[model samples]
Target: MGLFDSFSQIRNILKNIDLAAVHKLSQKVDLNKLMGTVSKMSEEDLAKMLKFMQAGSGDKRPKPEVNGDFYDLSKTLSAEEKAIQLKVREFMETEIKPIANEYWNKAHFPMHIIPLMAKLDICGLTYKGYGCAGKSSLLEGFIAMEMARIDSSISTFFGVHSGLAMGSIYLCGSEEQKQYWLPIMQRMEVIGAFGLTEPEVGSAAAGGLTTTCRKEGDEWVLNGQKKWIGNATFSDITIIWARNPEDNQVKGFIVRKDNPGFKAEKMEDKMALRTVQNALITLTDCRVSEVDRLQNANSFKDTANVLRMTRAGVAWQAVGCGRGAYELALKYTMKRKQFGRPIASFQLVQDLLVTMLGDLTAMQTMVHRLSQLQDGGDITDEHASLAKVFCTLRMRSIVDHARELFGGNGILLEYDIARFVADAEAIYSYEGTKEINSLIVGRAITGESAFV
Candidate 1:
């Protein structure tokens, strides 16, 4: 037969068992029983069906594009913003994806990736001047999501540096301080870390900072310990928040790496975000020069302002983590076979997958608008707090569902969902725990603060 005749002959056979027919049969047959029957089919029948299935797919398999953005929220961004978003996505997939699990498993920071990441020029994305791109808050949120999609540890590391540490200065530092540090930090030449949560104080950091800062003639003597400070072990500069002994007001200082009495011990055996170099920082009469004091950070209110801004980005990171896990689970289900059928062909499995996608979509849409409010300058403490609470809650649910879909492989780090499952816990508790953030929104909208 001629090539065209053979092709036409195959097409005729393909039409007999196309995806549409298979989908209909799947609905009529009990998935478990149907799989058993397919497994028992004769070799000739199995081969013919497999060939028909492939041929029926033609050039387009009609596979649903694996996406967590159910409502297409990225459509709201402008073309330029979308381009930047895609650029960051490509960077994460190309640079971070391969090394993410390895570094995360070893609990080691990949130092070499820093300069490559810096070349992307995404740090201080929303800030204007100081060689920044001056993009909107939405773009920043997208970048956070992109990073977390591949590796949440890298996202958290970047967030601690660019959002919290750099933002603290951008929002509160004096003009000279801004001119001095913003440019270097923006270029990622000088990495940063925020030291706010102390060993004794976690969620209560606003009201209780055990770390004390006493002023001397030319420097501030800092004494106290900071716990779970991301990137602290090797960050070039750490923003240490401590209560002033004289005034009882919280203050911030740029604690340089070479401070004589400063020590940062790597926090080991973290179940989540292992790639992040979280440190239990110790300061024994660590004297930071007066020039290093954040001139405008007068109180805990200043610290809260920085947290308020970064909390929204954390919400977006949760979305990314959830979305990444969901995509992995969905793709696995579509390919993983049991008996003779893909596990995704089962109704119950599809239900779980759809549920995960729903949660992922909700989280994405919520953060999308949250960033919009921030860019509009209409964002309040409650606006960000609410997003943090909602998105993290949904993220927890999505990760759970995705993990369940993976069966035993879900717990295996090689599957990737295991990392998301563990990392989601840290994201849920960090910045502000769900309870703390909920009270913030409660105080704003209801005029009653339940927090004691």
Candidate 2:
């Protein structure tokens, strides 16, 4: 071939090769000498070289599926349970995921989606009667995971309604109260909130609730403030826990939203879980009928029963948050190119991904066993507390690593990883902080009370 004709053919061949590969090749070989060698090559040899270059120019293997469930724990669920899990997942992806960042950014609750969520018929999932599904706690845990996987704030709303509010009525209310409230709540017609944490009391709520309750004739008066009450701003009814001074024992009262003396001001400017409408509740001489009083909840121990059950669900939520962040980071790394290749191809990136997966997998399996214990009716305060402590702590780490993987974009809310990072902070602190939960487990193992 003529030298000009050969150079023309080589230019065409080089155009098809990856730029990064060509750049590397140029760094190693003398371009002038390579051209001289190529100019003398036969047409058949040139074609073979083109084929070899094309073959080695870029990755050709099919990419691995981005799944955080490395152990496939969902397979252990029954077919029916799996269906419910997938249904919730689909709902979150379709309805919640698109608006998650938007709503989270605005720090506003998506009130319009509540009706859509109600249609799932998952409210009061584990309760046996009063319009509940009577499903296993394992199924309930999966549902929580699915919801939080897409958005943690929505999960918190649902947990407050179904797990805490309805749970109080189911566990501590009179038979009449359960029969009356659970059906409407199950239908999502009457939203509920749990009011336990006070402005001055959170971890010390068991023994130091300053909110006072007094019984007078047929009306019981509740006078106290509750802080950080999720769903309180819009909840139809709130289960208010207050100290009855006469007995010095904590008691629960179902306070209606329209009561003249009850006011719930939305707590604003939160850095985490912004979509949740947490409230600073003020109960100035709020009078409830004797019938509204929780007949079975005579003391804080009854309240703790509700907390023990809900805390296990919180652990599952941490798994969901971590799972979401890990999955997002994994997908981002595969698409985000560095040095003309997917960052996922690099050793350090893979190492970080594996570390996140390890923490996520461990969190999932721990919550899986936690739900099993709950299903078998063998759950304890320490059991739930231990899961909550470990899972939330690991969730914090996973989100941190995920944010790190995104570099500067991690802090920008548009990337969604930023939301996971901020939300993880709230989960780490709420539903009983790590210190309190650890002490619970510590007390269990050592048989020694650490609270002074």
Candidate 3:
């Protein structure tokens, strides 16, 4: 080969090799002599030399596992708790991850997976009795993270059933009500939905519920609409929060799906969490018997208790969504090449990843402590609200960075980062919005009411 052509091949091989290895080789050998020797070599010899250097370029060491738990917080769980976490992780990875994009694209919930999820026996996991395992809130937080790591829609579905719906009954139901519903709901034989958000009232639901209930004889007549009611399309019962005209206090009722005046229409054309069947529910004089009333939920304070408990789970879901996107982006960078080397090796790409990991690790630690407070019975509205606000805000940034790493392909569903980006929007708004949650924390810190 000509000397110029040989030099060109040598430069190409060096570009593909690790720079550190080449620097070490330069220290041991004379570059002028090396170039002269290379100029004399045949094409077959040059190929063999290129292959040898590539093999010696430190590529033989196994790549580290791409775990999003940068801090290894899962190691803090007990052996049994870790086992349960792994079981849920396995279920999500095996059953949900494969079909996440397809179901999301079609905007249809995989009904068959409900039975499969039931087999996991995770519903009502934290409650003390009535078919529950009485697990710790920390473990429950981990479970929430695991579910959203695969698909946030499934996480939302489970959170609505186990956290909001069953939590209402567990916290506000009478002895008789709890005996009848908790076990069946925990076993997944019957599903539940939470109805609190109304057509016009969301942040002001504490005092401005348009859904009204009037008592007459043994039944309460409910008249209003509930918007963005998750799982209401197929839920057997919905925990409806309405204002009582008698005392102007919000009350909770277990309204059955078969109630004559109750109707739920599937909300369509949602850009996010499409696999979740959110419903626009209408209650035209919905008659719920007084027997189904949550006897303990006489006011909005009781409803706030349920929200306070579940908001921590929502924060955990944000962590899961961020973790999923971060891991996906990290994997993509390592495989996607730019110039010559993988994009992951680039300094700019590494900076984005480190920033994402910093935010994710901070979120993980915050929620870990939040669950500890909950388990210790010290969790407050402000505590949950802070995590909800911070984690979700960070989650949006993480998903954005993830999508940016994918460049143009980020918007494609086939790439998977697009789903995370889209789903992050829903997570940011649900359970509580940033402004509302920030005000909750603000009220707690300053001891001054911010609501007008």
Candidate 4:
């Protein structure tokens, strides 16, 4: 064969080799000596070498993004609600997004963010009085969704304070109690926690009140343990639900942190929603004045009323989580290239993205109606429970599909889906488990309570 033909054959062979390996090879080879040798070659030989280098280079092209909420649910809200939603989104993206993983990893709550979050003026968003905004329940649900989309732990923190704890007082507290606590709590100057679940009891908190309270002169003595109490560790006050010994009826008390017998210890090493400051609270001879007891909370039925409202918020939170996962996965798929094209363009990948969006949209719509029911004063426990059960179940499925789209990167915290995947577990269990909430609906339809 001719020498020129031999050189062309060699260049064709080198083009199949990896450019990264070739660069490494070039580094070891004396570039001056190599250049001296290659400079003697014809221009055609250099062109072939350049072509080989270009062909051997690995792809570094950008991928497309995958976003859920294709229907633009935000547009369904009023212009005012939409603006507030955007503000919340911006806050989550800017403030919470950066530190979420870190706090989650360490299982620590970011107390400093509480003051800043309160400044957003979103607490008691749906309540009509007691220094509240009196916004629509839809707006409140959307705000919960926005917070949870970025970090469910933070959302839980807010929900416990704004929804469960403060809501309990708003819905059941007397006018005097409202005047005393609502304004400070609205400003987040006094953080609140809800103590409902116990170490041995969770979903059965209703009709299974192990915590006991007794009247002693003008004060109520409380004794029991509460587990998984979010925001309890540093909360200014915790709403402790206990059974009144005299009447055997469930009652609510505003247990201040400095109360001599109120002890709250931080629960450690949680795998999901770790950024929330969960506490295992021990109330031994805790003294709460009769005036601090929620006057309107006559029974466990009243407590369920609070859960009904917060459960709807949980449904919205689930939608936010699914939306976040879908959006992140879709974005990753579009940008991550394989086989010389974006993965998002692949059929199977598109299938997953579409499925996630469908679930997200379903969840969003379901919660929208739920909020409407709440606003119209026709919301039932079954309504909120059904939404909670349905949305959270779908959310788990959506996050799993989203993680699948990320391939190896799906498991990494930096990708964002990992947090959603983890947070979904807590969302699934808290407020009410799938079984508990399902039975709440089951009791409504079948007229039978299956909960043992």
User: What value does the lDDT take at residue 265 in candidate 4?
Assistant: 96
In order of lDDT, best first, we have 3, 2, 1, 4
Cα miss at 71, model 1 (Å)? 1.3
Clashes of each: 0, 0, 0, 8
**Residues 208-327, model 2: lDDT tens digits:** 999999989999888989999999999999999999999999999999999879999999999899999999999999999999999999999999999999999999999999999999
Across 340-442, the per-residue lDDT of candidate 4 in tens digits comes to 9889779999888888888888888899889889899999989999999999999999999988989898899988889899999989888888988899899
Q: Of the pair 1 and 2, which is ahead by lDDT? A: 2
Candidate 1 runs further than 4 Å off: 1-61
Instruction: Choose the strongest candidate by lDDT.
Output: 3
Error of 2 at 257 (Å): 0.4
Error of 2 at 37 (Å): 22
Stretches of model 4 off by over 4 angstroms after superposition:
1-67
Model 3 scores worst on lDDT over the 10 consecutive residues at 53-62
lDDT of each model, Cα atoms only? 0.90, 0.93, 0.94, 0.87
| Candidate 1 lDDT tens digits, 276-312 | 9999999999999999999999999998889889999
Please provide TM-scores, in order, for all candidate models, with all chains considered together.
0.88, 0.89, 0.89, 0.85
Can you write out model 3's per-residue Cα lDDT over 84-193, one digit (the tens) per residue? 99999999999999999999999999999999999999899999898899999999999999999989999999999999999999999998999999999998999999
Q: Name the lDDT of candidate 3.
A: 0.94
